[model samples]
Target: MIDRVRRFNRTVTQRIGALNDAFLSSDRSLGQARLLWEIGPQGCDVRLLRSRLDLNSGYLSRLLRSLKDDGLVVVEQSGTDGRVRTAHLTDHGLTERAMLDRRSDDAAASILAPLSVRQRTQLITAMIEVERLLVASTVLVTACNPRHPDARSCLRAYFSELSHRFDGGFDPTRSISADEEELTPPAGLLLVASLHSEPVGCGAVKFHDDARAEIKRMWVAPTVRGLGLGRRLLADLEVHAAANRIRTLRLETNRALDEAIGLYRAVGYHEVLAFNDEPYADYWFEKTLDRSTAPAPNLPDREH
Candidate 1:
């Protein structure tokens, strides 16, 4: 597997002109070319560019300087906040970016030109898988205050999705809630998953003083589904629960979310008798995490 992956890496990098200092038959290296593309016509905040590209501060500064020296880009400090800097493309940079786009399209066409229709379909499918897995690998999950802007963004999306999917048109106020107070600090936590600085998923947990933890507000963006992010979020919540000395973990879900139910069952959650009166819940599940001595759930799974 390692050899296959390494050979694939070699083939793709060589085919993509990654080894060339003059990529796309241009004067700039691929790094410089990518910088221009990322800067785009609207420009970008320098710090954000660094995060999105995963570049070291010195390396990014050096690239910006090199582009500036070539008169291909401009970097300027914000008027209100001198500490903040933004990168904008010059006329030449825009032209260069356009040329790069054309060349990239040509390169893609060239790769497909040799393949039969079936091979092309297979190649495209494989490429999609590779891209999805790569993006999934880059996602970062962190515990944060539920009130943070990005956290709120994920919750808003979650609620909007629920409203559309629920038969009666869901209302947050009608359901059992994980309010801001419940998800803050010593009581509970909200975990937000980010991909290239954009929030992609979020999950929360409320503790009952080392006795149990209830998972809440769990969601992953539609664009990023089927990448196992939901499982990652669940495993992280389990870690948090264990750390908090929570012996059991529980969650309730609406019948509209079948995928979520499948995930819970796959990850060891078992249906139990109604433990809470959450209005929207059609199923309630729980898992006991006992380290030293505990039998797995072999008992028949009960459902409401």
Candidate 2:
């Protein structure tokens, strides 16, 4: 499997001119070119560019310097402190980007030109699947305050989704409490899952004591649902619970959400009697973590 992956990488990169000093027939190397693209029309914060590309600060600084020297990009500090830096494309940079776009389209066309119609379709489909999985794996989950803007945004989306799905319609006030204070530290924690710096999902855990931790507000956006984010969030919450000496994890969900029910069961949760009188809950489930190791192996769900 390792050999296959290496072979695939070599072939794809070589064929795509990824190793070329001038990518897409542009003067800039692939890294610089990509940085320019990411800057976009509105520009981007220098700190964000470093993070999104996972580049070291020193290296990113050198790249930005090179672009500035070429007169294609400008880097300036904004705000009263003059500490926050941003990189913007100059007019020359916009013209260069347009050229790169054309070259990229032509390069892509060249790859398909040699292939038969059937082969072209198959290759494109396979590439799409690969891109989707890659994006999914790139998702980052971080613990944050439930009151943060991104966190609240995710919850709003989650509640809106629930209202659309639930037969009687969902109401946050009537639901079991997973309030801001409850999700704060010493009581519990809230996690936000982000893809490309945008929050895509969130999960919360409220610890009652050393023995029990209840998972709450677990949700993923519609666009990112099938990427196994739900399972990832559940596993992360379980890990957090275990770290806090929590032995048993429990959650309550509505019957209308078949996917949620299946996700709970797939991860070794056993259905139980009503643990709490959560108004929207039609089912309750529990799982005891090993504590000695990570969460249990994910059993294949029917949908997947």
Candidate 3:
């Protein structure tokens, strides 16, 4: 099994020209090439890079040092916070990156060069599936700021979905305000799942001064719904709450949100009296987060 997996990885790496030695051709490893691509034209936060790439601090630091030594990148402290750092590519670095881009294109073209038209189409289709699966695998659940672009995007999608699903047609303008700061750090939290460059799902937990938290605005995009994103989002939110010392979690949902209710039930949330005067809520749920047996529901994909 290990050999099969290793062989599969080798096949993919070879096909993608990952073994090439000109740096883009061979000298630098795939890691360095990917780092340069991620750096792009605008600089990126070092912390954000680490999270996005799912890299360990030591390994990421080593990669950054190598890029700096090669005169391809520079890292500087943030103007607003000395503790934060940003990375930007130098002129030479940009040129080198452009070459790498060209090489990648060439590599992809080489893969298609010998294939018949039908074979090319099949290959592209299979590649898309592989890409999506790989993307789904890489997505990590981490605490996030509610106001962060990805989180806001998820909320907007959530509201838009509610408007379509609800009898009255939901309106965020009329919806109760969700405090952004509450989702920032120690006090409360937001969890986001991103696949590639897009945010696919999110969940928020707002902690009271007591030990309880209100789970709010939980949502998964229609496109990615069936892949168990909702359960993952819920689990991540609970984990975030647990880390912050929150014991009880409560949530309210509209009657139209039957799937959510089912999810809550499957996850061991019990029916409870209304905790808030949510104009749209028809049911309320409360659960004491138990890491051992949280509900793991399989979310269905939304039909297009």
Candidate 4:
């Protein structure tokens, strides 16, 4: 598997001219050119650029410095926040970026033009699958404090989505509570799934004295759905529950949440009688945990 990955990486880099000093025949290296493209027309936050590119601060700074030296880009402190910096392209830089775009299109065309129509279709289809899997692999799921900014963001989005999807519109106060205090350690823990260091999904498990745990706030951003993230979050939550000696895990969901219900059933959960009077719930699920074979609960607390 490792060899296959290495071979794929080598092939992609070579095919895309990633090893060239001047990518797409531009005057900048592949890294610099890609950075320029990421900066785009409206500009972007320096911190965001670093996170999205998975580049260290110093390396990103070096690339920005080179662009600045070439008079192709300008870095400025945000007026709204002195601590926040943004990178923008100069007029010359925009022109160069346009040229690079054309060149890149031509380069891609060169690759596709050599293949027959069927071969081109096959290559494109394979590329799409590869990109999807690569994206899925980058998502990092970790134990996060419910009070953390990312966790809070996910909760807010989750509630907002529920409000929109529910029949009478959802209200947290009227539903079963899974507050900050409840999600903290010893009581329970929240697992946040992040892509590019930004929270995209979250799930929480609340423990009880009787070796039972309840899943709460399980959600994944719409943009990141179909990546198997919901299943991943549920599996991790189950692992945490089992490691803590929990013998049973349960959750309740609204009938409107068909996807969540389907996921529960697909993952060995069984429909059960009302476990609790959750007003929004129309279905309840319970799962028996095999603690003897449960994986250790050593999920990371930072970017993976």
Candidate 5:
């Protein structure tokens, strides 16, 4: 099994230019090249980049220093909040990034050059699957504001999906209002998962300053439903609540959401009496997130 996995990795790496020393040989390491690409034209929050890359603070700081020393990027304090820093590529860095993009295209073309038409089509299909899986692997779950654009986007998508799934359809205007300030730090949190630039799933925890917390708006994109995104979102929300000293998590779901009910039960949530009079809720659940065991695995992406 290990050998097979290794072989698969080797094939993918070779095809994706991962083995190419010249891929970004101009001056930067692969990590730095990736950082440059992630920085983008609008720049990015340094803290966000760290979270997105899952890099240690010290290591990320070193990479930033290296880029700054090379005159390839600039880091500046946010004008609105001096404590927050943003990273932007310099003009030279932009030029280098463009070159990297071209190199990426060239590498892709190189991979296709040796393939017959049928083989090329098969390869592209496989590549898409691999890309989707890789994206599924990299998603991180953490506290967020429900009002954050990405979080809102995920909620909207979730509602849209429900509208299609429900016999009577759904309407966000009729759904419970999720206040932005309530979802901000201390009061509550929203967690969103994304693949590349697209929001794929979301969940929220609302803390009442009392011992109990409420879980709300749990959802995963239909395209990624089987990837375990729902479970990941649930587990992450529990963790966030626990960290806030919340002891119990309560949730309500519609009868139409049988899968969600099953997920909650399988993950240790118990049937509970109605906690709130949500017009849409037909089932209620409560769970105490036990930190004694390892948290549930992050959701895998739906396989094509």
Candidate 6:
């Protein structure tokens, strides 16, 4: 598998001119060109650029410095927040960026020009699948404090979504609680899934007497729903449960959430009698965990 991946990487890099000292036959390396393009005419936050490009601070700063030296980019403290820095393209930078775009388009055309129509279609279809899987591979799931900003973000979005989807709206106050105290260590744990440093999903499990746990706050952002993030989060939660010696895992959900209900059933949970009076719940599910032999759900490695 590793050999195949290395072969694919080699082919892609060569085909895309990633191995070239001057990408797109330009004077800048691939990293410099990408940073320049990302910092569009309107500019971008330096921090955001780093996050989006997944570059270390020093490396990103070095790229910005190179661009600055060439009189193509400017880095300045944001007027609204002096602590924040923004990267903007100069007139020359914009000209260079436009040239880069033209070159990039031509390069793509050159690659496709050699292929037959059917081959082109197949290649593109394969590219789409590869890109989707690559994005999925970048998702990171790890234990998180419920009160942390990312966890809070997911919870707020989760409630807002529920309010819109549930009949007559929804109220957290009326629903069963999965408060910070309950979700913290010794009681429960929350898992937050992030992609490119932005929280995209979250799930929590409340441990009860080391034998049972209740799943709560299962949610995937609408934009990332089709990426199987919810499943990944649930699998991680299950692993945590098994490690903690939990014998059974259970959850309740509103009928309006058809997808969530389907996920629960597909993952071995079976419908059961109402376990609790969750005001919004219309279905309950439970899954017995076999500590001795149940295999963990297959999941992609968490992004670092």
Best model per TM-score:
4
Error of 5 at 17 (Å): 5.2
Q: Where does candidate 5 clash, by residue pair?
A: 227-300
lDDT at residue 140 of model 6 (Cα atoms): 83
Go through the candidates in order and give each one's C-alpha lDDT: 0.85, 0.86, 0.79, 0.90, 0.79, 0.88
lDDT, candidate 5, 199-296, per-residue tens: 78888877886889888788887777677778878877776677667788888888888899999999999998887777777888998767555354
Better of 2 and 4 by TM-score: 4
- The positional error of residue 95 in candidate 3, measured at the CA in angstroms, is 28
Ranking under lDDT, best-scoring first?
4, 6, 2, 1, 3, 5
Off by over 4 Å in 5: 1-8, 15-133, 171-175, 294-304
The better candidate by lDDT, 2 or 6, is 6
TM per prediction: 0.75, 0.73, 0.56, 0.89, 0.57, 0.88
**Local error of candidate 2 at residue 150 (angstroms):** 2.4
| Model 1 quality (TM-score) | 0.75
Best by lDDT: 4
Per-residue lDDT tens digits for candidate 4, residues 28-94, read 7878998998899999999989988889999999999999999999999988899999999999999
Enumerate residue pairs that collide in model 2. none
The CA lDDT at 68 in model 1 is 95
Please rank every candidate by TM-score, starting with the best: 4, 6, 1, 2, 5, 3
User: 248 in model 6: Cα distance from truth in Å?
Assistant: 1.7
Positional deviation of residue 232's Cα in model 5 after best superposition, in angstroms: 1.1
- Candidate 4 lDDT (Cα, whole model)? 0.90
Flag the better candidate by lDDT, 5 or 6: 6
Give the C-alpha lDDT of model 6.
Answer: 0.88
